[model samples]
Target chain A: MNVLNPHLKFQSQSVAKPYFVFALMLFVGQIIFGLIMGLQYVVGDFLFPLIPFNVARMVHTNLLIVWLLFGFMGAAYYLIPEEADRELHSPKLALILFWVFAAAGVLTILGYLLVPYAGLAAMTGNELLPTMGREFLEQPTITKVGIVVVALGFLYNIGMTMLKGRKTAISMVMMTGLIGLAVFFLFSFYNPENLARDKYYWWWVVHLWVEGVWELIMGSMLAFVLIKITGVDREVIEKWLYVIIAMALITGIIGTGHHFFWIGAPGVWLWLGSIFSALEPLPFFAMVLFAFNMVNRRRRQHPNRAAALWAMGTTVTAFLGAGVWGFLHTLAPVNYYTHGSQLTAAHGHLAFYGAYAMIVMTMISYAMPRLRALGEAPDARAQTIEVWGFWLMTISMLLITLFLTAAGVVQVWLQRIPEDGAALSFMLTMDQLRVFFWLRLFAGVGFAIGLVCYLVSFMQRGRVPAAVEAPAAVA
Target chain B: MSETFTKGMARNIYFGGGVFFFLVFLALTYHTETTFAARTNEAEMTEAVTRGKLVWEQNNCIGCHTLLGEGAYFAPELGNVFHRRGGEEAFKPFLHAWMKAQPLGVPGRRSMPQFNLSEQEVDDLAAFLSWTAKIDTNDWPPNKEG
Candidate 1:
């Protein structure tokens, strides 16, 4: 009998395969550009004229966003069908949207690289729409419209499936999150001439997505994976999911004020932002507890040990990165010195990795084996390698954050905290922090090695795995 | 705890709390927008200042430098650059010289690419920076080296 045959529960779940593959490819690209930027920090003129720091940074950040979106789309495609207990409404539509999104994303990144940003703007009719040059929203106006279209198609495909099939809380929450993502993106088109007003509304898209709705996506995905690995009751997981996301929004929605404190907003945000954001870590703390609690209560030992490890790892890092590091500078008094510093960069890298990136990887870990018909899990050695990959990436990321935090502390001390006559200039402060930058670059290389190991684990499979044979023997 | 803590209650809290806090956020936004004219030096926003903002965006200055403590932190904060360099009469000339100096190619030092901006564009950027420097940031940047 042939092994490696597709044993998918739903025929349409295969539509997610291309998405997952494309996402990982883009993830590798994201890391490459990240390493490039990290090098530029130490070797200032490494690629000065050809690929400037701004361009490299833009590519680094934008690729991170796009790949994560790909990951999210893949997770939804896989999770929705299983949750609904039905085949996808239209796998063809899903595949088409995937191509459209992938093409637009690649073309936009090419445009950024090949053309001067100003030339790209003029060629793309940015004068008419004027939506370029904003951080993370720098996609040309046409690409933004394309993203909206792809989002609509995706939502419709997901919606129709759910409409005709089961309606579980996991599906409902994920759907709401996906819809919110599409809705909030419309704010990217609303750039104003007034800079303050421009920034005030920009958070509608950025803050609301990550802190507000993306938590819903992350939570639902985690709950789904926990349910599978723990053999826990769906009701129990779903309940915790709701409570976690509830806390995320309750604190996060108001916590948006923290960005407002120094950005020409009123001083009242000083009070409001501080109080609300101080409580922001509670949800992340709850996540750590919830993950451990679910594992402790698991009825069966999951064969996919790597997937379980990823799920547990996601919670601890998200708490430390997003929750703890975030709390360190969220206060207006502290942020006054630290805003726009490497401290923000540290928090950003860790939080995105822990909360979003790792969850997507967790989903991939859980779903890919079944999607590929590799049995309930890959071989034992593959799981061992993946566990190693997880630790390497996570520890190096923590080290990167710590190095940057040290750099930020020193920068603030020398630059921001001094009296007018005594303060060092920005460039001088940067010069003093070269050692930390070198350390961060090394940690980044470690992260890239971890990613390679992760990719390698996919290629390593010996005979038909024991997990695949266990169920047959039971039958 | 499992029996008493139902999904329905959790769901209710999610919806109810989400809407309630979102409404509060909108109210704060409304208050902030209404005060922008006073708070952000809107009265000083001349035609040149508007063109200066366009110049800023066209060049992607915010790509490397921060304005009002937002944007990439690769370069110095430019929100108060007008005040830091030289205010009023001398700031414009300082900016003109600064823009002309291309990629100070000092081997290992960070380099700024040459944008080849015109005299008018440079002056307009000066106007914009000057206007931005006047925004009531509640005494930010602590010192002049922003």
Candidate 2:
């Protein structure tokens, strides 16, 4: 806590409030586009020229990335100050960067919607550098440059704060993760003429970010929240954080080979990818244990039960989604059939939701109350609604993954597994899987409703009477 | 045992192990890059194929279709499409017609937008696809329908 500014622990943390608000707004936008894509999967021509499947998917995935970035930045803004034991280096710069990032994100998404992709590419002068049209990295080259500038400014702000103040393990891990994120993103600009080489390094951005550094980010955030909510010692939690992220990077760095198995890379990847990526799940499994063990060993009750639930949920689902489901087809042999299939989509949905989405939500749930000056947590009713939102969203996402997995199984059987003479065309196989698509759409609607509950929880008032509420029981 | 497990040792493992594995990753990337000329059939990647790739990116074809089993799975895989539609001779003509067909207008079935490309552009795209088909992909897709 800053001595001069005693209204809150640190007045600088107030900036995180707007970042959370903007992130939630973008999250809603992402979900809306996701629902549109879900409908298009079944109806095909539902929004054909108006909101093409490609455009909808681009918006969905890009918005997801942007919002999570916002969440990460917000988490950094809030946690960095406390860990450093000082006021932020520059709160104004943080706000300036927020508006810049939000503007860039909105304008780029509008470009995807309003102009034809080719026209947009030309308008943005992509021919000058030509880093457009790749999946996930679909932003125009200029926007990519804007992102790099924003990231540099952000890293400088956080780094300065840490330099002038204390350097805890949690803060150090987070700073490293943030730096790695910016470095890996440079690979998005490297579009070699050789498609094989292009894909080979593209995963340097995607795989290394998600499976590698992002785990560092996730682990630190989880550790911070556990320390706060569980009344656990920082040393104990910090050691576990180091161990979990150590496993994450050790396996995840080599795990990049998993994607190289069929991308015209060397055949050595077949053995290396399988062996290394098979170990990728170990860190996620360790995370589940670390989370539960800390909670079970909790010394005091935290009022923010919803935030704690989210922390626990993130680990379990990440293991199931990133660890288990990813392992299902990660082997070179199984991936030979399942690569690019709906199974990939299945794993992608749950992994992103379970690992990234839930972790961000955990931070928001934990921080929003304190940011608003609402004591330790929100009102009891609000917390209850948030808990419901957790179950609804988590269960719906699980259902969505299962439905897609079923679709992938059928797709592989009818299309990939059959003898060449008996194999069905891609469209024919898709036609056979309409039922699963419909089920996924229904599950998506459930997720949207869950999001609604979550948003509505923010509006509820009236705290639990302190005397009437008992402290949470220790395991 | 718990007391002996210090953050110092854990931090060392995180940093030291991270650097070690990242070095291994770099070595593997070096090896992969070295093998690209032979595995990707670099000799066959003509000037027209280069232009065709530009056309493909400019159109955002990857937004919907998969190449080398990557990208959106909405449309059929195009990495092997040159071989699937009728390779070498007939693929060029088939692609030209396919580009001109515009949206299919089949109501419920998936639609491919018309790019209204010139005959030469379509031919270039065909050349690119044909070249892509030659890349050594460890015998992927299991069948020709990709």
For all predicted structures, in order, the TM-scores are: 0.96, 0.97
Q: Go through the candidates in order and give each one's C-alpha lDDT.
A: 0.89, 0.92
Q: Per-residue lDDT for A342 in model 2?
A: 97
- Pairs of residues clashing in candidate 1: none
Tens-digit lDDT track of model 1 for A1-475: 1333475778788788889889889889999989988898889898888988888878888988998999999999999998999999999999999999999999999988888888888889888888888888888899999999999999999999998999999999999999999999999999888888888888999999998899999999999999999988898888999999999999999999999987788999999999999999998999899899999999999989999999999999999999999999999999999988889888998999999989998998888888777778888878888888899999999999999999999988999999887999999999999999999999999999999889888656334566557887999
Candidate 1 residue B67 C-alpha distance from true site, Å = 1.3
TM-score of chain A of each: 0.96, 0.96
Best by lDDT: 2
Q: Give the 10-residue window scoring lowest on summed lDDT in candidate 2 chain B.
A: B109-118
In candidate 2, stretches whose alpha carbon ends up further than 4 angstroms from where it belongs are A1-7, A461-475
